[model samples]
Target: MGWWKKKKSRAVVKEQTWDRDQWRGEKILEALIQCCDGKPNSIKFFTADQILKATQKHFCKFVFPNYIFMGNGTLDNHRMILLRKMKGRSPHPPRDICTGPPKDVAISSMVSDHKNFMKLVGCCFEFEYPVIVYYGGERQYSPVDLNKIVSWRRRMKIAEEVATALAYLHVAFPRPFVYRNMGLKNILLDKNGVAKLNDLSYCVSIPKGETHVKLTWAGKDYDYMDNDYIFNRVVSEKTDVFGFGVFMQKLLTGEENFEELCGWKNWREKNKFPKWLSSYMGEGRMGEIVDPKMVLEEEERCLMEAFLVLSERCIGLRGEVPKMVEVAKELRRSLKQGE
Candidate 1:
């Protein structure tokens, strides 16, 4: 409400041009007035062309799928939410959504109740396109945030927070919650620098005591998911664990596609560990597997090495990875050790 309460005249009534390529904070403010004809009392979800119309009177946000063009442009300059819908890919039926993972309905069901998830603010019934709004505004961004290099300490914090969030999903609800999309890009960073797991479109709750949930469709980002889940057409919390492993590995290596970067394009058949990581781990060349773009201090090196091993385990590198709770504890310890 603080965002809505302001001098009425301060928000001018006029048409303006919105240049995305050349839009600054204030430019967005000016254009927002034209877009939201109802200003303070009436700030709500606008369609892509509607967003584009405020400026060009034509361009559309749908032109770019899986893209963030900046709607966090509020008067306070605080980041609002990155609006999106159905992050999953095509070739799947609607009912499959119920079996695949949690969708907009699942997330909207948790908005007032769950803090770990990004809230579902608006809905479109005809298109089944539910609006996802991360209230962090300017303060929140994807965890990868376009591969911006972060310190081991910060990453460790992210690891702990994410692990805790996952554990919450798996155990908090009356039933076990399985986050089908657990990729790095889906996780977000909030104003407090806390890690927030977003994109519940693929999340689902399996009956307690039931080992797995059957699915006819595979979620998005094939590379980041557990092959067992896809091939077996069955999923459980462990499926999320597998995806988390790939996610962590991606975060560590900073590679857009791990299998491609490691020359293991056929890894699906072989299921071998990445040659670069296996070689470097044994040789004690921590620097090799670690992101080349990142520089770590001496003390941080030990923690990073330890962190890598834990990451490998999470992905089932050594046979079996510990549950998320245990993983969270390990990450928390590492954070304390750094402090």
Candidate 2:
């Protein structure tokens, strides 16, 4: 090949490599890890000079609307980044990534401890790939085995972790944090089988509003539906209490039909949640409503019953959703007695 042609080809390759390195920042890398099955084998790192070359072409792609996934497994592990990169054309800009309507400013403003919980050691970056890193517990055994061991004990542990996290969200902080999307995927477990909450992206601050009030329906199909209760004012702490009640039912009965069961339609038709759960609990048949994997001792049956009753009251009571402090207190008492 001619010298000029060979030189041009080599330059192109260098640019590609440089571009990949620049995109490997923390925000993109975090997203990549969320979607990855497991950690990569190794990752790349770069100096600031190389970072410019690597990010120039691909940076604009993610600036305002078009978000990019950094550690998508498609990228070679050697080129991942551990820190968040800038998407703006300006050399210096305030944190521009999380641009959205600040409805939940209270929740969003908290200094998230995610970075500390999973302490990042180092990272590599690439344009079309996730920035890789050597994180805390990086060499630890993956929790792949835990997913296989579904027992009563494990399920209860999961339930407690979720409940505690939800309780914290509902009451522990000075201000309430509303997690709009609470799901199994958003729950994380440590090496010790203890669970914690993750993914606060959709979390928002509860707006000022009344308790157990109806909201306005934004859709047209609900013409006949009661407009007073369908949709109206903003959600508050009580709304979270209701969500936790539904979540408790999901954990207990192992049901995935929370919307159908707790919706206005069913709730209106049969407002006997407390009575129904109480009947089941009184019969020592908490298992009937609980996940089959969770096995409770006969002695612990009453504790489970209390929890169920509280959950029922959570939804059944209109103006008086029990405070998280009280709820935790009751749960503590029940668990203590059971133990």
Candidate 3:
């Protein structure tokens, strides 16, 4: 009886595994059809064995937040970053096929041609959720590295690259996408110090002929979100602009108490800079407000002032925020002026 019971239990487990695999396979196939014009060959597909071997069964020591692991690819022998979906329940459950890992795989493949965007190598669909692979040699930026980034020029370059990527997403496609998540954490620095924008899990496309799309708030960071999104549940290209403004603020201030300084409390009523920060900008005290790590020269003072003004526009403190393309152009002009 004990032997029969054990056999039955093993059979049940096998059946469950097979069922899960089948569901995942169908979902992936549907996504590929919808996103890739029914062309499976558009993006490479790695076998489960290949991915496991590359990642050493998820035992790799180099791990980033959100289950991203660094490993050497078995096929190409090149460093790769493997992004796996979390195992447990998600904070925001998938409401449609447009959400989650499948969308990430599709979008990453579609935007791989852009230099500022992360290059998608392939994906493995053997697991319940697909494992995404990207060519590595890039390091993710973190809040801890604020002081380490001493050069204002380097920070400006990163900001420009990220803005260019966002602009590409906005105009490159027939349907413009809003990059809802735009923080320092999603910016990666390559070996040559080029910034690559990553993590499109929160990306959403506005319907054709529509300027904005309304969506349920799924963002994890409320501080980076704009007042219009928080109060009205609206999402548009302006949403990304607001997020970029917050990101630039962090880069400029390098304040450890970033949240306390420019948190929801500061912008809850109106989407504008806090009184303290506004005062510094109004008084033309660039030295006091800028990052202490960055030493401004006589000529660089004007450049810093221009950057702050641009950031203000992005935050909508000015009359009207400029489009992402305009923002990118402004940053490029600033870079040239510095040179």
lDDT of 2 by residue, 34-56 (tens): 32224342223434334434444
Candidate with more favorable, higher TM-score: 1 or 3: 3
**How well does candidate 1 match the true structure in TM-score terms?**
0.69
TM-scores across all candidates? 0.69, 0.51, 0.82
Task: Give lDDT tens digits, candidate 1, residues 1-339.
Answer: 111112432123121122211222232233333222333321234443333333232213331345343442321234343545444433133455352222443344443245556654442221223233434344534455525655766767777878888887776656676787776666766667777776655666686679788888775466656668867768888887777766666667776545555654566557664443544676666666676666678788888778778877876777776887788788889889988
lDDT of each: 0.56, 0.42, 0.70
- Where is model 2 poorest over a 10-residue stretch in terms of lDDT? 97-106
lDDT, model 3, position 323: 95
- Backbone steric clashes in candidate 1, count: 13
The total number of steric clashes, by the backbone 3 Å criterion, in model 3 comes to 0
- Pick the TM-score winner: 3
Rank by lDDT (best first) = 3, 1, 2
Clash count of each predicted structure: 13, 33, 0
List, residue by residue over 227-327, the lDDT tens digit for candidate 3.
Answer: 78877778899999988887877777775545555554666556665543455776656666777777666787787778877888898888899999999
Q: Which regions of candidate 2 deviate over 4 angstroms?
A: 1-154, 170-174, 207-230, 256-287, 317-319
